[model samples]
Target: MNEAVDEAGWDVEPGDEIEPLVQAVGKLLKVCREAAGLRVAELGEVLGYGEDMIRKMERGARIPRPEYLDRADQVLNAQGHLRAFMKDVERARYPRKVRELAELEGRAVEMLLYSHHNIHGLLQTPEYARALFEMHQPAYAPSEVERGVVARAARKSVFEREPAPTLSFVQEQVTLERPHGGKMVLRRQLEYLLEVGQLRNVVLQVMPTDREEHAGVQGLIEVLKFADGTAIGRSDGAFNGRPVSSPRDLRILELRYGMIRAQALTPRESLAFIERQLGEL
Candidate 1:
């Protein structure tokens, strides 16, 4: 038993749609180990994982990290058969909401966003994100925080798409000063905001807290527009906070978002404001 290894990190949540795939992978892993003439404990020793942990993995009760598969493939001499499951496992490890949002973001030609409490996931740096997740009320396990951080970072791929999306962000000024991950993390996040604000496809605006007329007081708002002319939007303040796709419903969210943008600092000015905040740090 490798006492030093942390093998109990990720598990397939009870109702995840990926359960069948994980089960299949788990059965395949067990088959490979048995064919190689190795017992569970023997395989665990070679993999630096515990026998109990190995049982959970073979039973489809846990999600294996990519490195685990890579090492398992080499140890079992399965010739990458085990390694082949890494991509699916990686996707399975992310929360379903993150996966769905990432898919929508991938298809979006434009994204309108307003963040009230924390830095937007797409804009958050990994360190800052990890810090924020670690502060969750129940106190997330270290594994959960890492998974969240990785999922958040993965969504930034939207920024790299060919024919980049027109991303408009309206952030509350308080998000700039909150220091969710401590001062250094906040400083890096501010610096990242400055860097991202320079992108031609992205418009980053900051809403001053002093404004008497604020439309975003309701909560976070997200609107994604697709190339096929369809759009989906959701805001905490409207429609029970459910996603709205009907033109009329989207219009309401859009109207409020337009006002929020109007009340926010201009993109160039927001960048300068962020720079000043960074300097103060």
Candidate 2:
């Protein structure tokens, strides 16, 4: 393996659900390399990967990046066979919980989000998200942080769905002032928020720190309602923090979120507030 590969922050989570799929793909990769009469080192040289990475990927011990599959298809003449796994591998690269949340977001026609200390994942810019992940308590490895950034970014597709969903966001005022990724990153994030806030189906609000009675004092809250009349919700201070789908449980979350919205600045005022913040930067 190349020196960089040895140090690269890529590792497959033990007992992950993606283990079987990765292993299967890896075995095929090995077969393809052998069929093409390429030694592991030779393959590594062409693919710009270290032998260790190549071997790990081939053993299904690592999730291959899409670029790896694409390049491998061309190098080994697999005729797109290897490329077919890109989507699966991409999904495998993230934790299953992130993917599950993304799936729920995709199916929802209405989403209500509240943030306590940071921007919601769907609203965060890639750079901002990267900075946030880089600040994790244990300090995520470069590869792990990259995975988080990609996963967060993928959730943004909700904004462009053919039938646009109603997206209501309430952010704590401190989230706007805190420079999570330095001043430049915060500036860009505010700019992006302004752009998104202007979308027809979006309602963005800010909850001020001075508010005497805050509904969101409980913490972050999220509720997504689908076209089929089914809805799911989760809150930091409710139900032991697990997601709830029953009408009764959802009612509790909705009640809290409704109050949060009522307590926040109106959408128009919020945009003006963001613009003012940006000007100060």
Candidate 3:
């Protein structure tokens, strides 16, 4: 396993806590495969993965996708035991920072977002997210890109949470215009934005490119408010671009965000703006 890890050129190592869980899952997979009388190559053939990938997964050097586990469960006749680890596998697939952010999002009672660059992670479509990752400067591996797409798409689950969070987003006009994933992807993204904007609990606004009094010139801003009135916020435009949890710092962010909202188009107007962009596409 150490030799494989060294040869694979993995950029990041799994944390101590996560390593054990993945190893346990891998052990179960190996045991199930053996019980089913299937060789690693045979299992790979059945699951559409390579022999090396199957070996890596069994050795816990690779994290399996939920669908992979589901297929493995059926193939190995583990009943539901293998499938039961889907949530853990999914959580492990994401980078630690993303998981932490997702945890905060899950606890948020209200989420306020202002995006000046690209669409917010919670709002991005899978295809769009994939395209963005594909174009990353360092260039993620295909597997890593796929993992990111899935992780980002999973974050949209926040919208479906019961006792739904009050969601608000303010997107810059340029952001809508910039085709991150080509025209077709952009069109779908706009349509999706329009669709999500219609939800009663969501407020989607647009800050036009022509705005002279933009309050969010500092960049992207996000504030997640919890049930107990506590909040966490971060801004690309803020001091050193660090996250802040203090009430005073949060209030400053709130003030800027409020002003940005005021300057942006109303939700209805933003929807119409998006519609126009879709038509132009």
TM-scores for all predictions: 0.96, 0.95, 0.90
Task: Estimate, for each residue in 131-183, the C-alpha lDDT of model 1 and write its tens digit.
Answer: 88888999987777878988899899999999999999999999999988689
Report lDDT (CA) for all predictions: 0.90, 0.90, 0.85
RMSD of each: 1.5, 1.7, 4.1
Each model's backbone clash number:
0, 1, 0
Over 182-219, each residue of candidate 3 has an lDDT whose tens digit, in order, gives 99899889889988999999999999999889999889
Which portions of model 1 miss their true places by more than 4 Å?
1-4, 7-9
Instruction: Looking at model 1, report the run of 10 residues with the lowest lDDT sum.
Output: 1-10
Q: Determine which window of 10 residues in candidate 2 has minimal summed lDDT.
A: 1-10
Clashing pairs in 3: none
Model 2 C-alpha lDDT per residue in residues 64-147, reported as the tens digit of each score? 888788888899999888999989988888788898898999999999999989998899999999999999999887877878
Root mean square deviation (Cα) for candidate 1: 1.5
Indicate the worst ten consecutive residues by lDDT in candidate 3. 2-11
Error of 3 at 249 (Å): 0.7
List the pairs of residues colliding in candidate 1: none
